[model samples]
Target: MSDTLWWQHGVVYQIYPRSFQDSNGDGIGDLEGIRRRLDHLCWLGVDAVWISPVFPSPMADFGYDIADYRGIDPIFGTIEDFDRLLAEAHARGLKVILDFVPNHTSDRHPWFLESRTSRESPYRDWYIWHDPAPGGGPPNNWLANFGGSGWEFDAPTGQYYFHSFLKVQPDLNWRNPAVCRAMYDALRFWLDRGVDGFRVDVIWLLVKDDRFRDNPPNPAWQPHEASINRLLQVYSADRPETLEVVEEMRAVLDEYEERVLIGEIYLPLERLMAYYGRDMKGAQLPFNFQLIFTAWNAAAIARIVAEYEAALPPGGWPNWVLGNHDQKRIASRVGRGGARLAAMLLLTLRGTPTLYYGDELGLENVAIPPDRAQDPWERNEPGLGLGRDPARTPMPWDAGENAGFTTGRPWLPLNEDRAERNVASLSADPDSLPHLYRHLIALRRGHAALSTGDYVSVATEGEVLAFERRRGGVRLLVALNFAQSPARLALPGDVAGADLLLSTQPGRDTAPVTAEWQLGPEEGVVLALR
Candidate 1:
C-alpha cells in the first residue's frame, strides 16, 4: 500500500481459459468469455489474472503444446479479441499475465515442421535433435513426462528430437543463441501487445545437460507415482545453465515497467530459491510451492513457513500456490471444511498468494468418466489416475444448465453439485467459502501487517497453527485450527485488548479473547493486537 510493488503485495488468480467460461455455444471458453467474467475476478478482489496459454495448438497436451507463439487459437478467438481483453482487464485495474511456454513447441509449429524436414534446414537447430544411441534406441535414458521415451525418431533426418513432456511437444534448443533470440522476440511481441507479465511454464527445464547424461533413478519414487517421477530429472531439468536462460528472459521482461515474471518449478526449497537469480534478477515470483507438497499438519506447516522464509534469498520476495491446473484442488485434497483454513493460510501468509481459478467456491476435483476423459496424460496412461481433467473442470457460474459456464455442454463437466456450488449461490450465502475468501483478501489488503509484514511463528498447542505478523506498530495475530475437533491455545500475550478482526466461522468476530481460547474445528481467525 505504501510504494510497494503491486505484484509483491497483491493476490494472483489463475484462469484456465478453456474452462473458465464459454461465451459462445462452442463448449470451449474464449477470450470474450474471459472478458465477460472480469466482474467475477473483481468481486473476488484479485489484483492480477494469470491466464493459462490460449495459443494455437494441436491439443496434444491441451494448450501447453503451443504451435504458434504469437497467434491465438481459433477456439479461443483472434488477436483482436486478446487486445480487447487486455484493455478491458487493465480498464478494471487488473494486470493480465499470459502463460509463456518457452521450453518447447508443438510438433506442428512451422519451425518444428521445417526442422524435421531435414538436418540441413536453417531452423533445424531451433529444436533439440540428436542421433540415436548406438543400439538404435532413444538418445539416452531421458523419458517424457507424459510417458515413454523423450526422444522421437525422424525418419527423414535419421535423427531423434527431444521432448520433455509429450512427443508432440518438442523441446527447444536453448543452447542455440538463435533459438533464445527468437523466444525473446516472441516475448517482446506480447509485451508490445500490452500484456502485464508472463507466468513462464516449465522454466527450470529451459536448459538441459549438454552431455546427454542419463538421469539417476528416484530411489523414493513409488509405483503409484507418475512414470515421469521414476527418474529424478536432475539432468533433464534445473540444469546449471538454466540460469543463463532465466537471465535472458528477465532482461526481456525488464524492458517493460511494472511487469512481473512467475516461474512454475517443482524443486526443493534449496534449489527452488536459485530461480530468484543472482542479485534478485530471476523470476519476480519463483512460485514457492512448498504448501502443495507439505503434509497438512500444523507443525509441519509451521516448519514449512519457517524453512521457506529462511530459504528466501536476500531481496527475494516469497509467494505461495495451493492449487493449479496440474494438481488436485485444495478442497478435494483437504476435504470440504479444510478449504476454509486453507484460504486463511493462503491469504494471511507473508507473501504473494496465487489463488487458482475456482478454488474460492470450494471447487473440488470432478471425476471424469472414461467416456469423457480428455486429458492427454490420462489417456496416455489410463490406469495411473494421472489425468489433470479432474482439476480443470468448467467453472460454476450459476445454478443453471452447464453451470452457466456455457450455453451448451461444457468442454469439461461442471462439479456434479453445481446447483448449490455455483458462484451466484455462494454469494447469496454470507457464510460461504467464497465470501470467506473475500473477507480474508479484504483483511489482507486493509492491513499492511497482514500483507507484507514480518512473519513470526507463535507457539501453539496440538493441531493449532498460530503466527504473528508485525509491521511497525501494527501487529496481527492469526491462529488456525487444522483438525475437526476443537482445540484451545494459550494466549501468547496480553490478549485482553486484542480484537478479533476476522473469523472463518460465521458470526464470530470483533470480540475479545480470554486467557485461553477455544477454536472451532477447522477455524482460523485474524486478531488485531493493540
Candidate 2:
C-alpha cells in the first residue's frame, strides 16, 4: 500500500463494548475492559479500533438510545476511563473511533424530556413532531425498524414524535438548525478528547420526507421477514435530502485535522455512494455491509465486489465487513471452513477491512435461550429467529470460567465452544483461524499488492474464485474454494508457476505452483506471481 493515509492502508477492528471484556467483573464490558485488551488488538495487526456507543443511556436499545451526548454510561466507565483508553490506544499506534449517534436520543434525554413535556417547550422543534391525523392516530404510516408504528403519541404534548427504530429513540429533526448545531458540538466533544474519528450511526436516516407522506407498500416483502420491511420506506429512509445532512456532518468533522468519519449505511450500491457527498466532503468511509448480507457464493460475492468497486466515486475508498454486533456472525453464516476462505477474501481485497471482535477465531453465533435473549430487535419480533443476541454474546478471552470475560455471571452466556475457540486456544494453533488472520495481516502489511492492489477477476472452474491483486510491478494471485468438495482451478495461460506465500491449510509451503492447482475443500491461498 502507498503510505499516504493510515486509514487507507489499515484494517479496522470493531468492538462491541458490552461484550468485549469486563474489567470490574460487572458482567458487562467497560472502557477499562477495552483498555486492557489493547495488546490483543495490537497483536492482531489491526490499525484502529472502532468502538460502538458507550454513552450514558437507559439501555432501551443498548447504547444506541443515548440519554447524554457527552457523558459515558456508568455501566461502561466515566469520561476519564475513555480518555485513558484513547491514551493507551495511541501508545500502541492504534487509532480509536467512537460511535456517534446522531439520528436520535433516548426518550430520557433532557432535550427529549423537555420536548415531550409541552408543545411550547424550546426543544420541541429539535425532534420530529407531528399532529395526529383527523382520526387522532399516528401522523404517518411509517414503520419502526424494530417493529410497530414509527410514531409514539405523547399524551402530555397532544402530538406524536418520530423514531426510526425504538420509540425511546426520538429521531432528531436535522432540518432544525439548533439540533444540527448541538450534534456538531457532540462531534467536537469527542474530537477534543483525542478520538481519531467517529462511526456515525444510521447516517442515511438523518433526513426524512418533509411532507410527512406515507410510505408505499412493499409488494415483495415476505410474511416471514422483519415487520419493518412491510413498507417500501420511500418516505422514511435513503432520502435524497440525507446527502446534504452528510455534507453538514462532514463539515463538522472538517473542524478537526486528519480525523476520519465512518457512516453506518445499508443502502444498495447505487444509493449508498451518495453518502460521499457532492464534492467528496462526506464520510471518509460509509461502512459497507455487502459482505454481511450477500449470498455466500463465489459468483455472488464476485459480482458484489466488482459492482462495489465500480460504484465508488473517483476518490472514495472502499471497505468490507463480514459481521457486526447487529448481524449474524460470519462463522455462523458460513461454516468454519468457509470463514477461512472469507478471511483470505477480506484481507486481500483492495480497500480497508473491518474485523468484528472474535471473528479472528471464527466465533460462531452462540444460541440464546428464551430467558437469555437480550437484543431489542429479537425481543420486538419474538419467535421469528431475529434476535441479535446470538451475535453480541460476550467475547471469549480464555478457557476460564465465564470465558474470562467476567468473574460474575456474564451479561450473556458463553458460547458452547469458548474453551476451544477463544483467543488463547486458536492463537497457539498454527492452523487456527486466529493464526491465519495474523499471518494474513502481517503479510498484507509488507506487500503493496495484497494491501492496496488493483483487483482483476480471474476465470476459474466451478466453485473456485480466483483474482489477481497487482501493484507497481508486483502481481499476486488469490484463489478460494467456496465448497467443501475439492475443485481444480486452471491458472491463467500466460502465467507460469507461482510462489505460494500463504494458504488456509496448515503448514503449506511457499512453493512453486503449476498451471492447474487442486484446491482442497474450502481452501484459499495467496500466491506471488513469478
Candidate 3:
C-alpha cells in the first residue's frame, strides 16, 4: 500500500463550482464556498476533489471557454481565493484536481483576439485558421459538436477558424510549438501553487487533422440524434497526433512529484485504451465512462466490467464513473434502489472511482423550465433534450432556502424533493444514501482486497451480478441484485461460507452465509470469505 499512488486506490469527487455552494450569495458558488465545504468531503471519505473550470470566461460555455489560462474568474473569486481553497483542501489530506481546458479557449481570450486581428499577427497561427474553400463556405464539411459547421468564419482575417464545440470556443493549434509552450507554462503555474493535478477537459480533441479534411458521414445517424452525430468525426478529433500531445502533457506532470493526469476521453474502449500511452506514460486515469452510458442491469454491467478489465494495458490503471456534471444523475438513471447498488459496485471495483457531487444523496435531476435553461447546447439545439442544466443544478445541502446552497437566488432550481433529499436530512438517517456511500467508501479503504485486489467475475443466476476481489490470502465477495424481487446467489465451491462485511440495505441480515445467500431487491453485499 505504501508503494501505491493516491489516485490508484483513492476516490476522486468532482465538484461543479457554480452548483456546489455560494459563499458570497451571488447566486453562484465560489472558491470560499468550496473551502467551507471541505468538511463534507472529509466526512464522505473521498481522497480527492476535482473541480470544474473556474478560469475567467465570458460564460459562453460556462467556465469551459477559458478566457485566461492563469487567472481565476471573478465570479468564482480571484487567484488569492483559489489559493486559500487549495490550502484548506490540502490541510484536510484531500488532493485538489483542477479542470484544465487545453483544447480551446474563449474567442475573447487575448490570444484569440490578437490572432483574429490580422493574418500576420504573431499569434495568428495560435489557433486553427483556414482560408475559405473555393465554394466560399467553411473550409470543410465538419460539424460542430454544438451545431452547424465546425468552422467559424472570420471576416477581418478572411479565414475560417475551427471550433469542435461552440463558435465562442476557438480550438487551439496544438501543432504550433508556441501554443504547447504557453499551455505547459499554465500547467506549471498551478503545480507551483501546490495543487495536486488536473482533469484535462476534452483531451482527445487537443489535436485535429492537419489537412482539415471532411469527416465521413455517420451511416447510423438518426434524426432524433444531435446533428453533430451526423458525421463520424473521423478528422475532427482523436487524431493520431493527439497521443503526442497527451505525452507532452504527461511530461509536464512528470516534472512535478506524485501528481496525476486524468484525461476526459469519450471514445470506445479499444480507442480509449491508447490514452494510457506506451508503458502508461499518458493519462494516469483516462476517465472510464462506460458505466454512465451502459444499461443499468446485472448482465450489461458485468459484461462491461469484464471487458474493461480485459482491455487494460499492462500495468495501466482503470477508473469508473456513474454520474457527472455532463450526465443525468445516477439516481434518476437508475431508481433509488439501483443507485445504492451502483454505489457499491463503484467503490468495490478495482481501480479508482469518481463520484459526482450530489449523487451520494440520491439527488435526481431537476426539471428546468424552458425560460430558465442555461446550457448552450440546449439553447443552440432546443427540444432535443440535450440540455445539461438539469444535471448541473445546485447541490442540496439542507432543507432551508435554496437548499442551503446559497442565500441569494440559486442560479438553477433545486430538486423538487430537496427538502427531504438534502444532506442535512439525509445525514441524520443512518439508512440514507449518503450513509450508504460513506459506509461503502470506509469499507473499501479498510480492506486491501477491496482497494487493490485482482477482479474475478463470478457467474450467477437470475439478475444477480457477483464478483470476487482477492489479494493474496484475503478474498472478498460482492453480489448485487438488479431486479425488483429477491434473488438467490450460490457461492462458488471454492468458498463454502463467509461473514457479511456490509450491505446496501440498512439492517440487512448479516449472519454468516453457507453455500448460498438470498439478496433483497436492488441490494448489494460485500463479504469476507471463510
TM-score for candidate 3, please give it: 0.99
Compared with the true structure, the alpha-carbon lDDT of candidate 1 equals 0.91
Off by over 4 Å in 1: 494-496
Root-mean-square deviation of every model: 1.1, 1.1, 0.8
Please rank every candidate by lDDT, starting with the best.
Answer: 3, 1, 2
Indicate the residue-level lDDT of 123 in model 3: 98
Query: What ordering of candidates by TM-score runs from best to worst?
Result: 3, 1, 2
Best by lDDT: 3
Provide the global lDDT of candidate 2 against the true structure: 0.89
TM-score, every prediction: 0.98, 0.98, 0.99
TM-score of 1: 0.98
Give a tens-digit lDDT track for model 2, residues 1-530.
Answer: 44547788898999999999999978999899999989999988999999999999999888999999899999998999998999999999999998899999999999988888888889999999999998879988999999999999988778999999998899999989998888888889888888888899999888999999999999999989999999998999888878887888888778887788899998888888888877789888998899888888888888898899899999898888888888889989998889999999999988899999988988888888889888888889887888888888899989989988999988888889888878888778887888889999999899988788788888746788889999888989999989899888677777777888999988776558888778789999888886
lDDT of 1 at 519: 88
- Candidate 3 clashing pairs? none
Residue 373 Cα positional deviation in candidate 2, in Å, after optimal superposition:
1.2
lDDT for position 404 in model 2: 85
What stretches of model 2 exceed 4 Å from their correct place? 1-3
Whole-model Cα lDDT per candidate?
A: 0.91, 0.89, 0.92
Worst 10 residues of 3 by lDDT: 508-517
